[model samples]
Target: MRKKWITTSLIAMFVLTFFAPLEARALADESGKVTFTKGLDMEGVKISVYHQSAPLAKENVKSLCFLDSYFLETGYCVTTGFEVGYNGSENSRFVSLTENYHLPIDLPATGYIWLETTTEDIFVEYTVSDYLYTRDVVYMDVFVPGQSVTVFGIGMSDASSLQLGEKIIDGKNIISRSSNQITFKVPSDAKPGGRVFQLVNPISNAIPVYVSPVVFNDPYQPSQWYLAQQQIYEAYDVFAGESEMVVAVVDDGIYLNHEDLSSKIWLNEDEIQGNGLDDDKNGFVDDIFGWNFLHGNKDLEVKGAHGTMVAGIIAAEKNNEKGIAGIADNVKLMPLIVCDTMGCDAASVANAIKYAVDNGADVINVSLGTSGVTAYSEVYNEVIKYANDHNVPVVAAAGNGDVNGGIGFDLGQFKQSPVCNETKSSDVIGVGALAWLVSLPAWANYGSCVDVYALGEHVVSTTVPIYDLEGGLYTAADGSSFSAPIATGVISLIKSAYPNISNAALHKYLTASSIEGILIAEDAFMLIKEQYTSADDFVAGEVSAVDVDIQAIFSDVPGDHKNVQAIIYLQQNGVINGYPDGTFKPENYVNRAELLKILVGGKGIFPDAAMYNNCFPDVKNDWYAPYVCYAKKEGWVGGYPDGTFKPDKTINKVEALKMLLNSQSVQLPGFVDVAPFEDVATTDWFASYAAKAKELGILEETGYFLNPGEEMKRASISENLYRLLTL
Candidate 1:
């Protein structure tokens, strides 16, 4: 058998990505920056229905934060000062001061500027210097009337003498104070209407915040474990939805008239239903709700169970004594059939995405995946990215189990098309299936690329009456496919509440709020069996979790260590070693040299030092020279921008993932219009790399920020490698 050798070139390709210089930012001495929006730049601002505020073109909208660097965001969904959770149909979102909306060119560039808002209007305004934007004093929030609520945007910690629409909320009512928020109790007598908050000690002009009661009375909501696991209930408690938030379901077909889904069907106002003409002038003829891209006709019968199940999971009528509750209480479902009994193809799927974007879909759910399809299609990825560029987020399934049958396959094993296309499109949110609440379901196609996970086992959702139905209203469905709609439903709800939230920010919130995916070490080890031709080549002895005594080897990894099995496997194979002090600092960060040694030694690669001495100007003829030079010669490692490879420095998750995937020749996901991470922007160099890493399941972190520059801890590096190994 050929020696199990890890190509040093792959590590070299990733080595250049490791030493990313963190720019030291000047300490901002400024306070909260606010941007007074259009139609509400003064106190008691009100607008007449006839007021035709100049609408800013979507492309021209710009936002500025620290360093005076402005980034473009669509005017339709740009961040504004008014963060109200009320109904959103703001037309003149263009601003007058600062970043969002349309900032009038004539407004004062700096210094004190009064911002005023009324109970009728909700928006944001510039507070501090134009440079800093850390705070906004008061943001739109619901006052629960007697219960303490967190008003998140206020920056003033010493702020006191609070008043909600002339109702004095004394300083004593303040429960706690933090940098970004001040939790305070609302007056019991607070009326149920929009109220502007006022505070003394560094006065702040605030937006109108609507306070009202919110609740979900769906009878069967309690039975759905997915809702709780995904924090759907918590999201609904804060923001309500509207019918305007449309989520297009591109599937084989949906039961358009299902009892629970009938009312939620999106009606095309421009098209005359039953009329054979292209009444809407958009595209298809008589496309009242959604068109069928498959047969080229509008025969949207429930050809299969998947579409209806997906639709119900997205926007089934809620609190209507329905079979079960959807993630979004109020959302419109545009059922566009792009598949038939033969299953979905590239051309039709692309058309469906284009249709959804053009036809006013706030979110798109493609709860489908290929079982063994390995063909590449740029058209499929382009359309997915196009929708993302147009502010429509597409949520897709990671996969059911294996790219084969149910045996199990890792997306890392090869390339997955459509679902995670070649570009690693930031727009497509690949959702994995989580079973038993915490486990990444065995067949979920669990890999380095799935963005998030949701309950996908034994889920109850609306199905056609002709099929297997539960209570004659719904059926029990299972698959990672269902997970897409679950995420889409949440996106629909959020889009309606914060109409100004861009798809990028919406994506950030979605993934950041996700339950972190997990894979125990023993299971991780077992899953990697397919990666190796022989069991002895992978692990020496039995694969059971009970056999490994990690403490006996490293004296640091306890029996309960999450990665104990992996550590044992690596240590026993002569891959990794403890410190001379006889302790394996699992929590310690792994540096470039240590990581290369672990991986190279694990793979049993023995490079001829004389032939591989000169790797780079920085990578000298040291202990790591053989691995670096060998990889460099093999075209695995590329020199950095500065023409040097810093193999001694530490690396982050993104660099490591990019190196591993690139080295293995794993097909990376395609380019997306936006970067999903809050801290990583579209223009960042590591944006696509980071996104690709995320798609390949190399980065399993769930949060707003990727913290891409932070050092990779030893255990995290092990977990990441293990993920790649099993993937």
Candidate 2:
């Protein structure tokens, strides 16, 4: 909220202002004066200038021009030439010329020169210039071979003459050509590898092209509706999870030798297996696979069915013709047994958390909660805090108290447990169970504290073997307990893919990417797809840190700008972009089209435009048409009853804030004694948004005014977007 002033120096000011007049003069000739429109003296090695609308004594006559005097401080001789061409529409002629000069090595100044023509006199000023370098290139979207796609050469001068890798195509290959898009077929023989498609006309350098192949090859993936529903399959196509990251299932015990789970279990390489000694001494002796906090040893034998099932949800081996596919295909599961048949105590669970954190667990899954314990205790809170301090995410289950459609069973309303307390650290994600991947399960808890919902009703996963006559090893169960692990698995996938990502960022990514309301399976998948794809642009899995250069993404955002970091973060995450020039234009006010695009793309709230019926009269065929249509379809934004979306109009501060809050499904807080802002009245349309923004601390309290109807600037929106993402 603090303002930072950016000042331009006097030398820079002189260059910009003084160069403008010279550039303008180079374009036009006024008052019958023969002037050098480019500059008084050509300072650069290579220079070209145009004398516009100059009166010529005779048409189509050759004019000889030369620099009157020269003293070279540098080595080469000065050369100058001029050519006269008709101005076409007017009787006046234009003279264009290139001047090349060299200075002697010892001379301090280049001597002045005056030009005398047969009919006129021209004045020349002497000044030393630096060399100029320029490269001409066209931008185009590259596609996979054999696909007819529309590619836009946004800044290309002559798009019609564009060629693909120096090869020209026939008319049959060209679908259509317009000012904006050039629809063409990529030749079947176009090889896929590097992105280098050259343009013939205008002589552009090689341009980058992107091509992605759609592939799904998991053997048992078809049976796992949950994976496809959440679009984990698409995510896998980009990043199928990594084995380097470990997810610790802090629960009862896992069936370590299960056919689907045996290969994927975490092994402490430092500790010798079955050594019966304190090998890699952290605390416990012979903790090979994982520690058993319940028995106080490394015996990981399964006593309860819950832990094994939870472990399978996080990581069951994939493509081994197994019973089911876990959310992550390449993650290592550390089974830390904390309970037996009776359930775990605070002390035992805390120890398990410590064990997981000390042994390099990137993520911890605590699917069990103390249902009888209510208040925050040092024993449990300290351990959870250790995980938070170590940058490990702890996923816990929201207690299952739903009886009558989650009416009185909300976690916020019920304060009956310790581990599931509302006062838990924000690092701990409390997950609620959803039936049919949409509604809250009959036994699932619901509340504002529950960060997200996952499919927990009748969830099928690996379980401990029941050796009776007709029993199977795997089974289907229902509870928030199961949902916690599912959410944990998803987090594990993200963590594995982005190993260096902070715990806070991981939490934000998961919650922000989660689908709201009755989450449609396909919609959830789209959200996951977006997250994975957005993250793909960033460098991941590096040993050190990687900084994303804002200039690489947005040309207008200088690396030294105050808000450049926030702008780069949002831009890399696909949150915002209003211009095709690769410039963010941060000083410009945000428009309705831009806002809707950010909400839909960044928040992952609305589906693609193709899924909804078009209703906005003014948005059809517009660049932001899809976002506008999606917003209207979801009722996040409403148009006039007459059916129009004035998308180009600048969005006000209140309207922008409300749409952002609405996109995240954040509810406005109840009335309080203090008003949110001096300008916001309770009866106003955006009063709730203002109040909620204040309640969330999104709007600064000190020296901050709610300029309600004022247009929101791009820089202001970038800051707000950072808040929304980090929230």
Name the candidate that leads on TM-score: 2
Model 1 per-residue lDDT tens digits across residues 216-247: 46544434556644545555545344547888
Cα RMSD, each candidate: 29.2, 30.6
Q: Candidate 2: global Cα-lDDT? A: 0.57
Give lDDT tens digits, candidate 2, residues 32-67: 222121112222111122344344433332332233
Best by lDDT: 2
Candidate 1 CA-lDDT value: 0.57
Off by over 4 Å in 2: 1-223, 369-378, 402-408, 416-425, 467-469, 517-727
**Model 1 Cα shift for residue 311 (angstroms):** 1.0
TM-score against truth, every candidate: 0.42, 0.44
Tell how far residue 393 is off in model 2, in angstroms: 0.4
